[model samples]
Target: MMGGNLTGTVRLTRLALRRDRIQLPLWILGTTVLSSTSYTAVREQFPTEADRVTALRTAVDAPAILMLRNAPTGTSDGDMMAFQILAFLAVLAGFMSTLAVVRHTRQNEETGRSELIGSMVVGRHASLTAAMIVTAGANLVLAALLALALIGNGLPAAGSVAFGLGVGAAGLTFAAIAAVAAQVSQGARAANGIAAAAIGAAYLVRGLGDAFGEVQPDGYTMTSAWPSWLSPIGWTTLVQPFAGNRWAVLVLPAVFFAALLGTAFALADRRDIGMGMLAARPGPARAAAGLLSPLGLAWRLQRGTLFGWAVAIGLFGVTIGSLAGTVEDAFAGNEGAARTIRELGGGGALSDAFFTAMLAMVGAMAAGYVVQAMLRLRSEEAGGRVEPVLATATGRLRWLGGHLVVAAFGAVALLLLAGVSAGLVAGLGNGDLGDRLVDLGAAALVQAAPALIMIGYVVLLFGLAPRLTVALAWLGYAVSLVFGQLGELLNLPQAVRDVSPFSHVPALPSADVTATPLVLLGVVAVALGAAGLILFRRRDLAL
Candidate 1:
């Protein structure tokens, strides 16, 4: 009987792999490249032991930096690199794992794909088993590739492998959490959101632990606080890749995965097919006034997500803005570091330049919000909700326009909120509260133009190739992010840099405001959006 429960596991695993062939490779390779490139840049910037120590000291002295990045165990090249990049890599891997699991398990059931498969002589556990197998395999591949990349960069093989395994363990832990979330949530979206929230919470807990951690007498080493023990991300960092290489730390995540998997399996047995452990509440029999129109319905669908993004972005902005005062003090004697910050931030006073760079980074984050907001259309269409809506008095164009309006305005609102929060914090200390608010607010708001461009391109993909829209839209965002953030580090060509809409936005406060790029970008965004709407109207609705 147990054997029968997983009878089709192998075939289902193969099917999952086939579906994720492109996506998995992209996730793995993209993560590896991010690590490898940062390693290269770190090596170039800190050539001597003293330089590396100074860099480590700079980070150690800054509590804000400690809260954002991990506390270093030493001043070695590998230690610095891991301290700087590993946290981000772990988060990325966690997201990839959670999304992969939910996509295979809950998403399949949500779309009725699991029902069709169940008609065959397959075991009840086959789908979940297959999802775990595929997600686990992807994490393993990411670990191996990342380790190899580090080894290729001349790091010790043992430490490289340890770091890779640490990241993989973090991802696997989140995958198990996602499995349980899948059992509890009625819909794929809620499952994904729950798993993602777990990841975010883990990161925050780890950050708090590091921020309040005790510093060693050596001044270059520190130990995380007790909060670290509660987070998988903290556990991964405790693996201490280059410093201690604590192989035993990996056991925590292993135990976590086992416990979560057991709970998920038990819950799976309790839940009915196409149902969750927690039942959805019945809605009002009559539609609310806000649900009467396409625009109203779009707003209702997106408000929750938008509010979440607003809070996260606003807090991040405030955190970054507060750091503006510390920049000069931290890098006072380090001309090389100062020069790099200046270049990133643009021209003017050192503090102004810092704010400029921060706002630009904020702009990139806002663009992500745009991508997610625009993708809601695809979600609606894929879930068969669009048909019922269109069956009403709504036209295709009105429906699409309603979502687009929400996405566009939502992006602007988020950016402006970030700006206001950041500017408010930054100006309070400088005694230039009014001036700073106006400048930074405008700088952040200008980001909306490029963000809209992202929306247009995503809509275009949805119109032309509905099936490929999700993958391609995210791919486009990743490419643009690489171009905007890493172009200087990678020494990418200017022509290539031009491909990202962010590259065109004028760096504000530090540099003089220019209207030409902003105007042209707006024009291009309008044209792309118009073309997408026209094509969407002409194309038949995707089944």
Candidate 2:
């Protein structure tokens, strides 16, 4: 019999379904909707061979894009359509799978729910098995929905199957990875942290490999450098679904998953229930100076996230900045390509439009950190951990203020860092570091205040509507992204673009800073943050 298997898996399955009925279905629905939306948008953008060829030429020559999306295979243009989104979609699929599996295994054990079940006649491997099965089942549904969505949109039938299978294979492989992680960690939080780290590592690996194709410049044949083959994101692109549809590559992930599943079972057999093969040290009973208040506690919980955001945004700044010289070259050398880049933005001027476009996207990406950090306060409160702090001498306003300190300050920091980094690099390329850095930093910060306003709303939602906060806030971000980036490309309604704070931000590189728009956006942020804190103070704490 498999270790960690329990006869109660059936009961646990039903129980798990009941608990996740809304959340799981919502996740599935969101992915399905997004996939459909992407399919429609991509198809519309590159409907002809000429459009595809131009895209391939621009993308292949651009290291930034190749780093972002896998290199196109010079295959059919229609098949190449999937290239635009395959990286992100694969990452999302893998992340969702790892999260779902980790939630059932380590997270459940962390909360002691798994222990409660472990005390029942659960077999050694049943809980993990049942969890994997359910997770795999969810992947299947995703696969079906994804395939149906693509094919329904007129994608080739075989290519759609390959696309869906690639997604499912990624989910399965990550599920197996989480299974192994669950066996090594003493608690769910650690397991979850580890799995998330793994997921991130996978993305980084794929990015690196995509940037410098699995081969090294000085070619020593680094076997361990096989991150490309190791990452499912890299593997999915190998399928080349919309093009030649390399069907056999799909089995690589499937086989890797089988191997991982075998290892997870072996590890499970060796470990005791609710315990890992590795021993864990107990957390300090005494509080640190940083843990003294609600906001501080929120900071303690969220500091890792803040640091990560700063680093990522800064690097992204470097990338965009480094491309500044390249943009000028393209502007001078190639009119057709420049127009395409311009079509991508600046109505006409190549460099200014490019910077404006890059700045807007980077600024938007900065919110990924803000939204989650803002919502962290709500998670603690709803999870029953905040009541004890509130019962103490802490006032609700001060507590809320602490987390807000991180959110507000953190957003400002990211914008400045991103701008400075991008500007410094871009300016250096133009041989004027001092002036360039100042220009980039100023523009980046100009947009930062309004970005803060959006972050404030995420926090507000958390305080006022805990259950709906995460989804609604992220949805708002998506709306902003669409409006800021594609509103012009898609010719979306004027009212739709007007809904985002960013749509109002003048392309500062091309236009001088105007105080009216800046002041209004700043006021919005202030009001939203104030309202969130006030509401939080008035609301009842959970438990």
Candidate 3:
């Protein structure tokens, strides 16, 4: 412990809680509500044993539902319900934990608050200790809420507890992972990015395991290639909450937490505050020609992110493509489900409906791509990186427009891939090979305008409140996400549903595709972009 002037830690703790109280509730409550709502609705709709059997038969064959929900094969309907809901909740907890950890630790250190406190009587690792304690407490609350919500929704106590523990473990695991990331990054955003990448990897690994969990032969289940076992998320899913009630599986994330956190604290003891074990390389003595313009500077900042989105969305498309055939099999022999799928697919066929949903999911992901590009406005301005650019010859509109180019074009790139792949897979499954690519590609392109609306919101926030811009943009997106997938199950307020841009997109495949929402979103985006540039040009840089 530094044990110098120990006064500020309590005050800082209070301030941090005050700042995060609303945010913490939103993350936790949104997760709980989403999970419980889905559980309750599914349970109600499929109350009879026969209902579960039919639903499982339908879902097990439908690859879209299978991939998204990660429904366990050959399990009870109740077990399938747990599987569908818990996977989503685990992800919510993991990401929220990372956000909380980075917000308190690395962000504090990056903003110089830790230096002021290091001069105080606090222990050397007091900030790290505080962050862990606060996050751990939040996780306990989440675990308790999850347990209560599930049990209250009429799930058995033991299975509910197992579900809660699995989620809590995921939160703790990512918190420890974030701690290590915080120790090695100089800035909050970089630390967050690294930690988030770990979370994304965990999901991919877990999803792989779930996807690979097919049973074979004389009573032994075939294991996924070892990649699944290595992921904490994968371990969480394997808990088998209802069927086996495998509570012991919770130990894995705890062991991971102990090891990761110990290493992080040991690393903390070795490095000075604000400096990582790995030092950053120095930048060039002079700027590159592209780096000299406001547009150039914006591109420099966003290039890494754009590249990442491109890869991620393309992969997402590929994943959906691979699953199309599996889904075709799931809805087999279930005439009602099959017809529903086809009608949704337009007057085409059942395969078309499934293709439309797959494309819609990818379209939503591309929206995510656009949001990242939009959020660049806040990052550049907040880092004081955009200041020098603004002091130069570049107009604010040109600066804003540069990033918008990536958002618009990058979304197109993502969706174009999605449409082509969806068509390819659907055609292969149904032997309608010729028109698949072009039709699906056109469907995916129609989704871009609505997705870009989120980008507009981010830019408007940056123009209005540069500091709160990122927070508000992310909060809005999170809310939209909660409403989008879970809306029907949750019985969410109509106003809430209306807030999401995705609400406007036609449920193609079955519903008539329309140009109204797409046109409206495009007009809104342009208006917001113009407003942001106008306001940014007039404001003084806080620096």
Candidate 4:
């Protein structure tokens, strides 16, 4: 007889692969491109060992840089590249794994597909087992691709392998965490939120540890305290792929993954199908006074997410701002680094350039939330929740408009929080609170235009082709992210780079603010949003 609890796992695994053909390939391709391109760019940027060493020294002393990237192990190009991109790659892998796990496990359950499969030859544990296998397989594939890409690009094979494996291990760790989170939350959305929060907390812990960590003369990196050991992401840094390849460090994540998987399976056995380990509590017998309108309902649905995003993004801003003093100190006497900083900042004060980049990144992150907020409409429709609301006096436009308003204004609020937070921290450090707050806040606001434009594009897709909204919206975001963040580093063609909305945004504080592009972007955003609303009103709901 087949394994009692995982009899149909193989079949489900194949089915999952078939279902995820497009998504899986895209994830793999994106990871590969980002890794290879980052290595290539770093190698090209610092052609000589002397240049690499100088860059490393400067970066290592900058708290902001260390927080964002790992400390360099040596002056070698591979080491520097690892320092520059490994943390980012690890985080990316974690994101991919979390989404993959939740999509196949909790999401399938929410859609009632798991029940259908269970009614067949599938055993009780079959679906979760299949999901784990598929996600783990995807991580392994990603690891292989990353290693091959790095090796082919001239990085040492052993180090490349270690780097790839470390990243893959991180993915597996997060996949296991997501599985546990799935067992804890009743709804797919809640599961995803929990998983995402875990990922964010992991990154934050690592960043905090790294920020306060010291790099010794012997090339050993030490965190300020033991907090680094608390995070899987932090464990990846200890792997030190190109530096020393601490193979023993790999054991940490492996052990954690095993424990998390065991806990998840145990929890799964305890919960009923379509339920979670934590029982859902009943709401109030009567709706709250504020729950009388469509806007109120939308706000209630979105408030938790909005607050989470704000707090996370605000803390990120504070971290970035707090590092400004260290950046200024580190680069003050380094001519090569200063020149590079000026060029990157688009020809203004180095601090301003840094703020400009930070603001841009915050805006991009906020755009992701904006798209998710807008897509809540599609989610509600698919769940048959929107129809009931529509059957009320609430018109389709009002229901849709309520979500759009939240997305638009929510994006603005997040940007403002990030900017003001960053500015306040930096100003307090430098003793210029008032001026810096106004300047940085305005810069942050400027970034909102491009974010709004991205929202408009999503709306256009949602209205014009509802089925393709999620895929197309995310694809667009990925393209924009790569171009906006890496275009200059990769030396991508200006024409290709120009496709990102951020390309049109003035590099504020570094470059003089021009109203023309801002005006054009604003006009386009309004026009696209109006068109989307109009089209959405005419088309039948996808549900």
Global Cα RMSD, each model: 2.9, 4.9, 3.8, 2.8
Please provide, for model 3 over 1-543, each residue's C-alpha lDDT reduced to its tens digit, 9 standing for 90 to 100: 345322455666676677678777877887887777777667666677676665555544444554566646334545866655667778778878888888788777765677777776677777887788778888899989988988887778888888888888999999999999999987677777787678778877776665555533422223334566788877777787776777777778888999999998899889988788778889899889987666676677767776876677677766666666665566566775675456434445555677677676777677766776676565556456666776788777888888877677777877887777667866786677577676777778877766777777777777777766656676777667667655654566678777777766766554567887778878987887778767777877642
lDDT of 1 by residue, 270-353 (tens): 998889999998888998998989999999888888898898899988987787678788768766556656777776777777
lDDT of each: 0.85, 0.71, 0.72, 0.81
- lDDT, candidate 1, residue 517? 95
Candidate scoring better on TM-score of 3 and 4: 4
Quick one: best lDDT, which candidate? 1
lDDT of 4: 0.81
Q: What is the lDDT of residue 542 in candidate 3?
A: 42
Q: After aligning candidate 1 to the native by TM-score, how far in Å is the CA of 437 from where it should be?
A: 2.7
Model 4 TM-score, 2 decimals: 0.91
Across 1-543, the per-residue lDDT of candidate 2 in tens digits comes to: 543355778877777667567656666676676667666666677687677666666654444555556756543533555666666667667766776776677666655676788777887677787788788888889889888988887877888888888877877888888889889977554565566556667766877666565322322111113557778777877777776688888889988899998998899889777688789767699989878766678777778777877777888899888778777765465455566556554554677667776777667766656766676665566446677777899887877788888887888888889888988888877888888788778778877755687777976886778655645675676557656655654455689777778777767575677888888887888888778878777877742
Q: For residues 1-543, write the lDDT of model 4, one tens digit per residue.
A: 337888888899999898788877887789889888888788788898777766766665555556667766776767877887887788878877887788788877776777788889887788888889989999999999999998999889889999999899999999999999999998777886787678778877887777677777744343434667788888887788877988999999999999999999889889888899888888889999877788888888898889989988998899878977876777788766666666656768888877877777787778878877776776677556887898889998888778878888899999889889998999999999998888888888888887788778888888898855655676787778778666886767799788888788888767889999999999988888889888988998764
Error of 4 at 398 (Å): 2.1
Better of 2 and 4 by lDDT: 4
Cα displacement (angstroms), candidate 2, residue 405, comes to: 1.1
- Model 3 residue 292 CA deviation (Å) reads 2.4
Clashes of 4: 0
- How high a TM-score does candidate 1 get? 0.90
